[model samples]
Target: MDVDNTKPKPDTVTLRWSYSPITYFEGPFRFKENNCCWEFFDGSATATINAKYPVNKSQIKNDLNKRIESIFNASLIYNHTPYKVSEPFMEGYDSKGNLWITPVPINLNLSVSGPNIVIKDSNGNAIEDMKGNRLRDIEEFAKLSIKYSGDPAAQAILRNYKSAVGEPNSEFCHFYAIREVLTTRFWSATKVRSCLNLKKDDWTKLGKLCNEIPVQQGRHQGQKYEQFRKATNVELEEARIIVKTMVKQFFNYLQNSESH
Candidate 1:
């Protein structure tokens, strides 16, 4: 009988990945819990996962990507600015210097495009921005998204909100879809508005802008192309702000209800 001498593969591994552009949150922000850790800095960000058992590297990458998405989504919700992170370059290895995964070059160039609104105090010092206290708010909102991850309605609203952020041409339609998600669940515009604590005038105006107007960006596909006019930036911005407020209020209501 021949004895096999091949060493068994290790069960434990550590995976690390980095992505950019760095989040708007003031950093270096660090989180370490549940076998996962991450750090966000001004010009760089990295996340790590310590797996006690064998896990797929691709799955780790996907999870990290979703986290990044949630962070960006939180940014949009709070700052009314659409931000995106580049695909993370990931690698995995064991304690014995055995490489389980190879480092992939980050070839994608992503930009953090938004107004860095800074408030100045008396004299010549920058007082506040979207960082300090706002970072805590963004973190809380992102965690709320994770807490409500099981609810279909909440997920739909988040998905539509993200889509609206990415699609500048059809921004109003996507934002309106968020309201539609609520209306579908509640089955009444009034009830939906009441639940979200939205004003009647504001809700009606949003609907009118998306459904009644003959804009090229209108939600209705049946409208003739020649009959539609482009929606102005002012109209788009108004829709974005109103929808953002509605989402924030809705999330707050959910958080409050869950606590009781």
Candidate 2:
């Protein structure tokens, strides 16, 4: 419960289950942004299993001791901290004083229940039932305004758009989305950097265009849509067109590249 933020973050955080064949997870981290639960991804493939609950020392040694292997049937392990191992069923410290577990497998068809630590396969539909898999079966709604995952820049753009959707001005949010996508520093910068489609010149030009969109002063400065519009004389429709065009161009580039 008492997370020492001062403690260094782990080099990597991973979740594993008894049946998993691979040890690493890349992410969807569908839980509340950097929280206890994580959704991991690998390239275009994403794993839906989220260790949606936190498990500490007491729960593990107490309730989970007898069912120890079951507890570890689904576990979340962090590389930096040796003192902790969290499982879907329970979390706690073991006598080893270090995480001895190796990565088992990566599976997109798996889903974990937060409170009960139930394992569901791709066939299970209900949250409480463990007979089916939720992640593989359900149609994943676009968390971002537009679900564009072909590359990192597009993903960053869409995620920023999802975050800014409820703001006062949709146009400003769209601008922010464009800025984040083109900035090449948001979520997956490495992929964005290597993207041949979103070149440095393109990034610089987009950033300069967005710069004229003034930001607000003071506390809620990020919510600078009003001032941004007034100062830049940019219209909502224009912003939408820019974003849509970029999205289209990125996908088109991908198609062309793959054909070659």
Candidate 3:
């Protein structure tokens, strides 16, 4: 096969290939594709990513650092020497001891799973304990904790700032603040689910509410609400044991009587 050896090969860029957009909390977060290593008329090179997300180029070069490895696990895999993930980037090196600037093939991708995000946090005590708008449940709880912890006339500081540099009063305030935060955040919803025997669907309202968790936290409250609405086909697995048991017993009784 006659091939033109003149043109430079295309590079790989940080791009997301297999992802369900609905699962994300933010949008306008773009995805890219590159390294079509078979496009030119000469069949020499392909369109490809540029060795980094368009947002950051140096990220790939410095991805092998320890700070990145601490929060993220890095492994380089593929045609021999693999791709490694580093903070702010993922990079691949070829067998030739050279940086594989080409868009790393999907099968040869330098994947990074962590910096794991909390896809979901179900570490609360109870759900029924929440009131008001189901969508604002977490926020409502947070607001309550904050408001209740602060009082000028109160002897003990009720804030939850926990640090070594706290004054005597800061420590007291932080204690209650943390306690209330824990009870409301974890005990009220997630952790309490197993205790309550609540199935996943039983937590639908909570899930719906959680969808409103702003990807930007404080800024895009509206966007968070929209993201929840946009979440496609989010089904919760639920079971009512008593209901199931009763149905089984009824069926058995009918079956036995019919046989007799």
Query: Which candidate leads in lDDT?
Result: 1
**What's the CA error at residue 75 for candidate 2, in Å?**
37
Q: Model 1, 1-260: lDDT tens per residue?
A: 12222233355333333444544553456554345555566535566666644467777777766766666676678666555455566545466656555565564454553445678888968887656667667777777776666678877888888887677678778878988888997899989888778999999889988888888666974686667788888888778778888878877888998879
Q: Which segments of candidate 3 are over 4 A away from where they belong? A: 1-103, 106-236, 239-260
Model 2 lDDT, full chain set: 0.35
Local accuracy of candidate 2 as per-residue lDDT tens digits, 1-260: 22122211233223332222122221232322112232332211111112222333343334222232211111211110111123332222234333333333443343333221355568875445321233322112222212233356655544444333334244454555655555454355345545534555554544444455454311234555556434243444344445444544554555566668
My TM-score estimates for the predictions, one after another, are 0.76, 0.29, 0.16
Ranking by TM-score: 1, 2, 3
Going through the candidates in the order shown, the clash numbers are 0, 20, 39
How many clashing residue pairs, candidate 1? Answer: 0
Better of 1 and 2 by lDDT: 1
Residue-level lDDT of model 3, residues 1-260, one tens digit each, is 24333333234433212221121111112111122221111111122344422325454333313222211110010011112321222334343434434344332222322121223248753444222222133222222222232222111211112120123212222332332343354456455344334454534433332333333212224563655322122321111122222222322333444568
Candidate 1 vs. true structure, TM-score: 0.76
